[model samples]
Target: MPGYRKAVAILMFAVTAWYSEARAGDTPTYSISIVPQFDHRRIEAIWRPIIERLEPMTGFHFQLVMEPTIPAFEKALNAGAYDFAYMNPYHYVVAHRLQGYQPIVRDVENDLYGVVVVAKGTGHRSGPSSQRSGQDL
Candidate 1:
C-alpha cells in the first residue's frame, strides 16, 4: 500500500508539472479521478491526506472526482474530464490508448495479481493449461 501511495504522489507531481507548463502564471486546480473500487466517502478519506500534502508541495489545489462506477469513470476519462487519474491496470491501458494519458509511475513492489476460483466438484483443473491463452486465463 505504501508503494501504491508513493506511485500516487509521483503521478500527482507529474500532473502538477503538466499543469504548470500548460497554464503558466495561474494556480490551476486539478481534478484527480480514482477508480471507484470503494465508496466515495472511503475513497475521499483514503486520498484526502495525500491531496493535502500535495497541495503544499505543488502550490495547487486538487479536487477529488469519484464516479459511481468504473465504467462511468472511464467514460469521463475518455472525455478528458480529469487532469490526473489513479486507475486500475486495464483502465490504465484503455486511458492511455484512447485518451493519450501517460503513466508517471506504478506500484512496483505490489503488483496486481488475478485469481480464478471454481467449485471443487466441477472437475475443473486449477493449474495453467495449454488450451488457455493468457487473456482467457
Candidate 2:
C-alpha cells in the first residue's frame, strides 16, 4: 500500500500547490468527487480517513462529494463542480477535453478490464455474442 499512499500524497501536494498559489495564506477547501460506483456512505467511509489524514500534511481541507448515480456524476463532472475527481478512463478523456483536467497520477498496481457475465446454458459463448457464439465470433 506504500505506492497507493505515495500516489495520494503526490496528488495532495499538487492540489495544495495549485490552490495555495490561487489563494495565498488562506486554507483552501477542495471538493473531491468520486464516480458513483459505490453508495455514498461506502465511498465516504473509504475516503474520509485518508482525506482527514492528508489535511494536516497538505495544509488543505478536502470535501468528499459523491453523486447518487453515474449520470449525476457525469453531469457534475462536466460542470467542473469538483476540484479533484476519481473517475474511469472514459470519463477522464471526456473531462480532459471539456475541462482541461490533467492527470496527475494513476493506479499502476492493477490492470482494470471490463467483464461480461452471462448465465450458463444461454448459448452466449462469446463475451458479447452479437455475431456468433463462442470465441470464434
Best lDDT among the predictions, by candidate number = 1
Encode model 1's per-residue lDDT on 43-129: one tens digit a residue.
Answer: 888788888877766777888889999889879977777876777677766665676665444555555731212112223332233
Candidate 2 runs further than 4 Å off? 1-25, 113-137
Q: Could you give candidate 2's per-residue lDDT for residues 1-137 as a string of tens digits?
A: 44445545655554444434444577877678878887788778766877887687667787888888999988888777787777767887777677656554454444642111222222323322234222211
Task: State every prediction's TM-score relative to the real structure.
Answer: 0.67, 0.67
User: lDDT values of the candidates?
Assistant: 0.61, 0.61
Give the C-alpha lDDT of model 1.
Answer: 0.61
lDDT, residue 132, model 2 = 29
